[model samples]
Target: MRAATGLWRWRHNPLRRTTDLAEAWIAFAAAALLCVVVPLTGWAAGSSAHGSLQRAVRTQQEQRVPTTARVVRQADGPGSGPRTADTAGEERLRRSVVARWTAPDGSVRTGTVTTSRRQSAPGDTFPLWTDRSGHPVTPPMRAGTARAHALIAGLMAAMLTGLLVEIVRRLAVRRLVLTRYARLDRAWAATGPDWGRTGTGS
Candidate 1:
């Protein structure tokens, strides 16, 4: 009887509910993890990956081309540019140039064709550019790398965590409702059937 009464009072009094507290705590924790921890860790990891790629590119370029050469004729613009013969009596220079980078899986990838006013002949060699720290600069500002992957992972984690937390809160609310209903059922069952009773009733 006491249990049923207590359950009934709890159901009626919204202030005594446990679901609200659980939901609030879950939301706060999730917000903190997403807005703070995840982004910081991802940023740190991405910076490291960027630095590593730069170093690797520089080392490879140095070993391949030890000396730099000057261009005699400027290359034409864009696609289908006319090729020019070298006045130095070397092989004709290629009008178009492509930059390549190796991925983590040891696969080589070529970037977009960059046509420079300075032409590069087939036999001519030039030192690849590097920053002060000897790191090759990757072109196409919008390109993705390991750093981007890390950031995307972080975002997915944040969203999943929020979803799980909300699910738990909903379950808690359902359990509370079920427990209250069960008590009400038991209370009504104990009262038994009440036939019509009154002084004037036949």
Candidate 2:
């Protein structure tokens, strides 16, 4: 009998409605699932994108041919080298190779190619390289590192998950508050009219 009474009271109680509780629980569960799945999806997408970019860059580099080129001049850094220190007044000599080639339009163009890795005179003959697209190629750009991709993926997933959780939580709290307010209104209406009447003196 006590259990039955308790159940009856709970059903009509403004503080503990089944519908409100269920909504809150569902919201919590949905948020939890999103937090787990968003990161995994972001990581997979980032990995695939990074791999595709790297492959494209590699293919472009491989098409260029290695040619004999002159070392025009070495780019200088902040610190002077041992040779520079020893030579008080000797100017560093730079050498490079120049070649002329006709384009598809039959226009002759001259370009200089330099290689610092080789020790050669200014007039040394070397093959200049042209890429598959017939354009002079430079070094390929470096792709994003694994660590950078991972960090990006993590940040993206976190933002998505946080947004989803906040939205669900807000909706759930709103529903709970509305339901409680409705119950309070109904309870107030059930009170007898005499409860609000002022006392009359005979």
Candidate 3:
């Protein structure tokens, strides 16, 4: 805002330096890019990410099946400890249990599965996700989760775009300032020896 105001105010000002106009223009350009390019970049990134993730979700849903597995017994051994479920939705601690279930091919499959049920015992049935071959797999990604990830990706892209624009603007302004200083230094050097002389000027 200040930059835009200065640009308008200095347009016809007789005392406005070239560097001042350049700086104001740079600021205006940066602001314009921030207003236009940043949101567009973010939306593009998010839309792409969302499309890819939705495709993955569909593939996972088709390849994975949710089946009920009956617990045979608690699996307490050297390798069996409190662990996390393979599903992305389940992040809490779960107990390992020996369970049996039928595969998509109608074959009986028995294996060690992780469950959040603390009081798991024999014959306790719980939902489990498995591949077509009956091997346990993680649950499919939820739609809400995919959307949240897309939103985060969009936000990150937008912030990065804004940051890049600001960086370029600052670098250009810094260069202009340095050039202005160099010109001032040259002018000072040319007149330094003649300063305060009695007849330096007519």
* Top-scoring candidate (TM-score): 3
lDDT of 1 by residue, 1-202 (tens): 3334455556657676465444445445555655676566556655666666556555544433222223333334432212234322322332445444343344444432323336465444333332233223322122344446556665566566656655765676577668777876888786645434445555
**lDDT minimum window of 10 residues, candidate 1:** 79-88
TM-score of each: 0.35, 0.47, 0.90
lDDT of 3 by residue, 118-183 (tens): 788799999988888888876789988999999999999999999999999999999999999999
> Candidate 1: global Cα-lDDT?
0.46
Clash count for candidate 2 is: 1
Q: By lDDT, highest first, what's the ranking? A: 3, 2, 1
Candidate 3's displacement at residue 140, Å, is 0.2
Go through the candidates in order and give each one's C-alpha lDDT.
Answer: 0.46, 0.54, 0.86
RMSD in Å for candidate 1, one decimal?
Answer: 12.7
Query: Candidate 3: where are CA atoms >4 Å away?
Result: 77-92, 198-202
In model 1, which runs have C-alpha deviations exceeding 4 angstroms?
1-144, 195-202
* Model 2 TM-score on a 0 to 1 scale: 0.47
Q: How many Å off is the CA of 131 in candidate 3?
A: 0.9
